[model samples]
Target: MALQDQPAYLIKMRAKPGLGDKLFALATEGMEKSGSSDRFIIAREDADPDVLWNMEVFRSHEAKDAYENSPLADELRDEIIELLAEPPMRIEVHPYSALPDGPA
Candidate 1:
């Protein structure tokens, strides 16, 4: 798909009760250390207050793969695992081809 047909890469996370906020915070912070992501959004599941999803958009497959394979990502994954009800699940999505002009 075209770069703009998709985000290049994404990570979908489902958080446990009372820990979504904390996990989200860590995820945001962790992204800075890698510096390869293009956009980040932590969304709460409307049906379940205790559930959350962290949507990450990368600049390219290589960038996303780099982050996924990096020590920083591994560190964050290990840390967040403790906060989850079960092991976090990962989903790769095709983001919108076009993003809004405002800050992502």
Candidate 2:
């Protein structure tokens, strides 16, 4: 998808030590219910195993909005916020193109 054709968001988070697994489980459940098939990337780059990155895509602004307003969204946000060691960093972007079999 071109930049103008897709809506995306990147949410970066850090969890308390030993909390990564729990967080990932909850996030997966939430995403599954969000009606979004967008892929995600999770990683740990520092000594702390808490660092995580979630990249999500929506077909359009309307689709994103609907997902955001859903009950699943509320549950997901609450679940994530409770597990965070700090507030998540969120960025919205428009993708120009997707890598082969990658984010689009």
User: Per-residue CA lDDT of candidate 1, range 28-66, in tens?
Assistant: 788777788777776777887556667777877778778
- What are the clash counts of all predictions, listed in order? 1, 0
TM-score of each: 0.74, 0.83
Candidate 2: minimum summed lDDT over ten consecutive residues — where?
36-45
Candidate 1: deviation at residue 24, Å? Answer: 1.8
**Once superposed on the true structure, which residue ranges of model 1 sit more than 4 Å away at CA?**
1-14
lDDT of 2 by residue, 1-104 (tens): 45457888888888777888898888877777677646555566566667788778786788889888888888788988989999999999866676768576
Using lDDT as the measure, the top candidate is 2
